[model samples]
Target: MAPLIAVAHGSRDPRSARVVTAAVAAIRARRPDLDVRVCFLDLNAPSVDQVIDAVATEGHSTAVVVPLLLGSAFHARVDLPGVLAAARARHPQLAIVQSNVLGHDHRLVDAVRDRIVAIGVAADDTRTGVVLAAVGSSDLRANDRTRALAAVLAGDTRWAETTVCFVTSTEPNVGQAISLLRSRGVERIVIAPWFLAPGRLTDRLEAAALQAAPDVVFSETIGAHPLVADVALDRYDTAVVAAARTRLSA
Candidate 1:
């Protein structure tokens, strides 16, 4: 079987790497025979290039590169493709098939709901407002995807209201979202970080949420959840199967 290379958007915070590592471990636990490796796109060690090079050196002719990203933003669209192209040029013998970004999966929604519930918010709490906080992107469509996810969560979890917010790069910043909720007479607001791991952005989101409303509840980052491992494997399998079909057709 081809190795699974899980690539994440690295962070300066060490906790972020740890969470990603844990998620990879979860994947290993689920499939002990599969060879799974973790790499980062930036701010951490063992970059995507390094991982690809290492896998090639280890005698793997083909491998699956799964972007552990939640949206089709800059990193997924531009950076990852650029890296893979460079890696392919450098190692012509290695067949590195890239997978799609992890976007808007129901398992992810369940993960977010699980986090909110862990923070004492009931699933049917119609009075509690939710602010689905994420690291904002320069692309409007990417930000819109976050809003769509918030809408899905609102409907699925039966929260009174769920609004989208960003920690950077876009409108409706965390403070603004919380204020909007407050204006809507939602005294009990919970800020759910739509992140797979804890990092500087999560800290900023938490601080902003507390400043906006003293009694605001903040959920933990959705780190190393079993559902994430499932999604990673799904992406890997999809990529591998597609690559096989393409090769056979060629």
Candidate 2:
């Protein structure tokens, strides 16, 4: 089997890289026969280019590149592809196949709920209010998809209310979202991060939420959840098939 390079949007926080590294490790555990590796886009070690070069150097003729991103934003659409194109130019013998991103997979929603549950926030608790927090983007539509997740969680239970707020680059920030939940008489609020890993943005969200309402608590981030690893592996499997077809046609 060709190597599976799981690429993450790197962060200066070592925790972010650790989470990704561990998650890819889990993928390896699940499929010991598969060659799974982790790399970063920036601010972390073993960057995408480095990994691609290593894969080519390792004598792999073709490899699958699975994006460990939650949103199909600029990094997914532009940055990664640009790097892959360069890698192809540098190694004409190696075929690099980029897989689909780990976008709002419904299983990920389950992972968020799992995090909330881990924090002792019952899914059916009516007094509880949930703020689905994410690192917002400048693209409004990207923000909208994240914002819409609030309802998907609310619909799952009788929680007082569910609302979304951005940690940056958008309206209804952490404080505003808490106030909106407060207006609805939700005294117990929990900020459930929709992120795969915690970083500076998550710290900012926590500080702001506490400032708005000190009583509010936060669930753990969606890091290394078995479901996330499952989704990534699924994306890799899909890309493998797609890549094979492309090669046959070419």
Candidate 3:
């Protein structure tokens, strides 16, 4: 059977790798026979090259490279493709399919919503406000994704307001966002992290929240949620189906 490789934007934080591994494990539960593996783009073991090389060495002709990113940013657009190109050159006969980043999936939205609910926000509390925080990317299109995600969550009646915030690379960092929410007369604010795991940026975001708006609460990082696993699987399936169609067309 073909192998499925889940690729993450690696970090120095071991928790990041652990979370990605857990998500891969959940996906494996749905496909017992097929080989499922987790690899990183950088800063961790089993880099994309290593994983693809192992797959090729094991005699797998086809492998799906699924990126565990929230949006199409530099890593998704440039870094991943570069890695895949190099890997393909090393093994010219290997068939590789690149998947899309996880962008605006309902499961991911639900996971964020769940985190908001977990932080003592009531379903009917109109006074409650939310700040969806993310690691800012230099890519404008990628940064827009945070706003898009906030809009989706704001539509729910439970959340009176949802604002997008970033830790870097964009305007209205978490601190500014929290102050803005408070200034709008919101009684309570919950800063929801749009990250896969707790990293240095997340730590800074939480610290800034405490300093800027001591009254506001911050939710836990959205790490290894089962819903995320589901979204990853959906992206993988979509990529595989698209690849199959392309082959037939050729």
Candidate 4:
């Protein structure tokens, strides 16, 4: 079987890396027979190229690179592909296939929903407003996709309204979102992160939310959630199957 390499956008925070490790461990635990490894794109060790080189050195003919990103931004679109393409050139014997990002699947809604409820906010509380937060991107479309998640999360319950805010971008921000919910006569506010792991970025967002509304509740990120691991493995399996089909056609 080909080794599955889970790639995450590395963060300076140690908690983020630990969560990535635990997430892949969940994947390995679910499919113990398969070889699962974790790597980072930047700001961390065992980078994507390092893992790719290791796979080639280990004599694996084929490998799958599953990006653990929630958005199809520059890192997912340009960064990882560039690394994989360069790796392919360096090792012609290795056939590398990149999997889809870990987003757009409905299962993630369940994962975020779990985070929301864990913060002591009732799912059906109409007076409670939700702020679905994410790391902003330069790609406008990617940010739009993140904004859509707010609606999906709102559908899960009757929470007053769910609005999306960014940690590092212009226009809509955490403070604005919190104020919007408050304007709607929502006294109870919950800020749910659309993040895979807790990092400095998440901390920044929480700080902004606190500044806007001191009583706001910020839930933990979707770190190492079993459903997140499930999504990564599903993407890996999907890519493997697609690669096999392409070979069959060839």
Candidate 5:
């Protein structure tokens, strides 16, 4: 069986790391025979290089890299590719497959929507507002993907207003987003974080939203949700299928 590496945007928060660790464990439970390891792109231990070396050392000639990121942003495009390139050079005989970034999949969207409902926001009531808060990205494309996801939830919940806000690099940071919703006559505001971890930024986002509107509700960060685990496994499966096709054509 091929080795699998789960890569995440590491966090200083131990809870964040545990979430990813648990998610990988769930994946392993489903496929007990496969070799699986978890690592981070940066800001934590077991870096991408470490994971690659470990896989090669274990006699695995081919490995799949599954990024646990929510959107295809800088890390997914540049950082992840650079890590794979370095690993490729170090282990020339090893075959490495980089899978797609986890972004806006139906399963993930459903998870967020479920969280919103759990926050006491009536699904049928059209008077409430929802703000899909995320750690912003400089990549416009990535930000757009998050906005599209918000639209999906908006369509399903039929909230009075659905806006996408960021912790950085975009307009209407959480506070302003809440104000916008209020201006539009929304009765209640729900801030749903699109982050996979509870880090400093996530704390700041919640604080700001609370400061702006004390009545606003902030949902839990999206980490290790069963749906998210499913999405990660789906990404790995896609890479496996792609690797098989490449070998067939070769």
Candidate 6:
């Protein structure tokens, strides 16, 4: 089996790395025989380059790099590619196939729904307004994708209203979203973080929401959910098949 390298966007908060570790562990639990490793793109140990070098030293000629990201923002488009290019150059014998970022997948939406339910919101609760919160990006398309996911989540969960908000680099910040919900006469509102792990941004979003509405409910980051593990494995399998096809074509 090809080694599965799960790369995450690191954070200064220690809990962030721990959450990622748990997520990788979930993947390992599902595929116990598979070799799984966790690395970070920044602010954490075992960087992507280090992980790639270790896999190469372990004598694996091919490996799969799975990006633990929700959207194709700056990290996915620019940082991960540059890191992979450097890794390929360093380990010439290793064939590292990069997998797609975990974009607006239904499983992810399910994970969000699960988080909402964990916070005591019923699936068919029409009185509670839901706010999908994310670490915003300069890429308009990335923001658009988040909005689309918010719509899907609202429809699937049958919430009364769903709105998109950002923690940075975008409008309708968490505070603004909560205000909008409150203005619409929503007495109970839940902010579902569109993040894989708990970090500074999640904390910031929660703080902002509390300031806006002291009674607002904030859900946990979608960490180590079974559905997320399934998505990680799916990306790994898809990358492996794609790599084999490329090899045969060559």
lDDT (0 to 1) per candidate: 0.88, 0.90, 0.84, 0.89, 0.85, 0.90
Following a full C-alpha superposition, what root-mean-square deviation does model 5 have from the true structure?
A: 1.6
lDDT of 6 by residue, 70-138 (tens): 988788889999999999999999999999988789889889889899988998887999999988888
Error of 2 at 102 (Å): 0.6
Clashing pairs in 1: none
How big is the positional error of residue 160 in model 2, measured in Å on the Cα after superposition?
1.4
Off by over 4 Å in 4: none
Per-residue lDDT tens digits of candidate 3, residues 1-250?
Answer: 5688999888898887887788788888877886889999999998899999999998888999888888787888899999899889999889998988876686787888887778778767899999999888787877776688888876565666789999985888987888788778888889898887777788888888889977878877777678887888788888889988999999
**lDDT (tens digit, per residue) of candidate 4 on 90-111:** 9999999999999767788778
Model 4 lDDT, residue 119, Cα? 72
**Residue-wise lDDT of candidate 1 within 1-250, one digit each (tens)?**
9999999999999999999999889999999999999999999989998889999999899989989988888898899999999999999999989998877787887898888899899988878999988888888877777788887777567677899999986889988998898888886898888899998888888887788778988887878889998998998889988999999999
Distance from true position, residue 162, model 4, in Å?
A: 0.8
Instruction: State the number of backbone clashes in model 5.
Output: 0
RMSD of each: 1.3, 1.1, 1.5, 1.2, 1.6, 1.1
Lowest summed-lDDT stretch of 10 residues in model 4? 103-112
How good is model 3 by TM-score? 0.94
Q: Candidate 3: misplaced stretches above 4 Å?
A: none
Instruction: Report clash pairs, candidate 2.
Output: none
Global CA lDDT of candidate 3, please? 0.84
For each candidate in turn, the TM-score is: 0.96, 0.97, 0.94, 0.96, 0.94, 0.97
Model 2 TM-score is 0.97
